[model samples]
Target: MTNENTAATALILGATGGIGGAIGAALRRRGWTVKALARDPAQAAAGWQNGPSPLWIAGDAMNEADVVAAAAGTSVIVHAVNPPGYRNWDRLVLPMIGNSLAAARAAGGARIILPGTVYNFEAGTTTVVDSTTPQSARSRKGAIRTEMERLLEEAAPDVPSLILRAGDFFGPGIRQSWFAQTMVTPGAPVRRIVNPAIGAGHSWAYLPDLAETFARLIEKPDRLDAFERLQFEGHVDASGTEMIEAVRAAVGRDIPVRAFPWWLMRCLAPFGGFPREVVEVEPYWRHPMRLDNRRLQRLLGNEPHTPLDTAVRHTLEALGCLDQRGTLSQAA
Candidate 1:
């Protein structure tokens, strides 16, 4: 399955992560030849226990030569790798992107696909943003994200790129996201749902659906521009309470709802990096940043979408929140 010559060949740079792994599986399901580059193939291959495996090429993404060599004969190179736990992220993100751009150029105009974030936008902007929105970053990560897209844009026709920008991700195999880290406790039954973005609208992208959208675009490269950016309007919880309601429905009961304790995280910020990182994104929870996907819908006829309750249920089961509760995940 790894080395077959298919109509569409994609080399996934971060196949062990949520977006990269999901997209790799989705593309493979659609008959694309998939290859993955990893520093430790044995450890990275464990991430695909439940799905088909990609050609696990032993390589590091930071090395331009490794990326360029692995990207040979590939039509798409997905730049999804990031510094673990945001450690040295600001210093490392751009160089990794530069390497991807170089690898794309080496592959003779192979498209570089980046799974983008809302960090590129101003915090709490109420307006729904499209692909061309002028990014005014509010934090250092946002600035880094903005610069990453700038690199892709500068690459142009020689190294055409696709940037599918979306909001927060919540789905199966995602353990570090807001849904897993703050919304629901991992490995524990749902006692009470913790909501950080209670009253404000928030854009959420289910990994399965997001991965499918990438596959659709990769299926037809003609629709893409030399350097294109498409905003995916995932499950828009216009009323921030919708997600909480969906969570309750997914578990088939009314559960207590609790507002996330941002103050506690702030108090503990000095003691650890995780809490400090969590405190920085409080603005997103306080305000809304929605995406407009009319451009995406028109291109694909319709954007891939899943019901919020179903998505939440699957995520809960994956996180083990639905365990010990008989037949919860099995219920329709």
Candidate 2:
């Protein structure tokens, strides 16, 4: 079916989230009927429910019956749901995905779109990862992500799964990322930029661009492998200064840059919470890694790329850092 065909329905599991919201918005703009599952539909709809607002389905992703019911008549199942606050991932991540897989099977082989992550591979792997790169995740979260992909790969024949792995994500409405929490304080004017990358070249994915990539890939599903897994080479900064420069250009000022507070995170890690999780994944920031998107380029010719300055400007504006004229807003 064509993108605007009413029959082209998508069920987004985490439509309330950053990536899911972006994808849902993109699909809606493409004329796809998008539905999102949330625990409390009424409350979620009141929030910034991500682009053009999806048809909200009231249900919890952990409930297999709920997901199965929501998957009915859906052509694409975007499995973007995850536990809240990054807690209980060990106990929650697998079961939720299992539910999604079962729902996909029940829907008679709907295409499953998953926003992939770098956690599938450890630092020992090639600094540059592609479709065929071997995965040996060393961290606990990485292992969980690796297992998630393994399950998807195993069920590919029955589900027609598509996995697009990308690096650290930064985009509008994304508040929990390194860019949001570490680099600049959200709901406040841009001040000194924090460089957590520790001189390590980090791969960054602009969410809307990545979401658009998904929409394009879905348009030509027939060309994809039954278990297609592609890499998204969004923006690769070799010296880790490119992103800083982008931020500088976006805000139109040379904000003082500071090293990330590893010592603070280390102290908080012992107390347990998001800081602990952040500390656990320090290796990624300390080491350089990038995804190779040649396979994606072969399929789509060119992946969506927003200029870093433009992307950063939009992100800061959405985060309430910049005014309409690109000047810093009053500090919160």
Candidate 3:
């Protein structure tokens, strides 16, 4: 249970997403009254499929009035909404954050919690970064992310904000990330695992563990600064072999390991959309970067960590790549 035994209310903006759903479920488990903004409340609630029953408010994150209405009596506003299928982020990202900021002010200085990423850092530099790292990212998307945080920082004292930064996300509840796209083929048997950081190390954040960390942070908001960004030092596999080994163990057998086809991806980037966007951020995989979570460790006594083997096994099971016998299903 949270430090406060009283039932606190929270408004989640992206209740349907992986991070949002994970945090929402965690908060609900801690006796928090969680509410969400959705275009269709009934359909969104149906997506939960017998999970925690959060009050779904019919609205959109981009609409300021909708956001404010949803956050009426909430103490924390989780801003996890993102552009659908990672499209139109350049156009929609800031606007959505702007709406959330407006709502935060209207809701009487409600605390804002954001699931942050490593995009705010400069590429090909700083293998290990802490909360004090400068925001020098040069990529288009990274620049926008930096701007979003800037807005949050500027709104400090009025609208307190907490940004938990982490690396690539993987786990149940969402299958639209690098782990879901590259590491293993979703909804198929594990035949081959793809490695993006072939020759370098990479960081990965398990959704469940990260969500639990968020819940802990929310429990002790008094320890956090008005506008603070903390790094979640999740599983950092140096050389990328550790993660490959974990996946192999999860499959309970040897599987073909393939390197991501950066060559082909670069060639197809000209067509625009997801491919183009992915190719533009190749610097991240090429460089070795890991978040330093010492601060988070101090705050939470110790960051929540699930063993790689167990985390991988659960992820594979959720992705439908593993069967009851701990072997690959013959579906692929």
Among the numbered candidates, top TM-score falls to 3
In model 3, which regions exceed 4 Å deviation? 324-332
All candidates: TM-score: 0.93, 0.94, 0.95
> What's the CA RMSD of model 1 in angstroms?
2.5
Report lDDT per candidate. Answer: 0.84, 0.86, 0.86
Q: Give the per-residue lDDT of model 3 (tens digit) for 18-53.
A: 899899999988888999999999989888832677
What would the per-residue lDDT of candidate 1 be over residues 89-145, giving only the tens digit for each residue?
A: 879989999999888888888999999888777776636688778998777778888
If the candidates were sorted by their TM-score against the true structure, best first, what order would they fall in? 3, 2, 1
Error of 2 at 74 (Å): 0.8
Q: What is the lDDT of residue 78 in candidate 2?
A: 97
Pairs that clash in candidate 2: none
Which portions of model 2 miss their true places by more than 4 Å?
Answer: 1-4, 323-332
Model 3 pairs whose backbones collide: none
Model 1, residue 178: distance off in Å is: 0.7
Compute the lDDT for candidate 2. Answer: 0.86
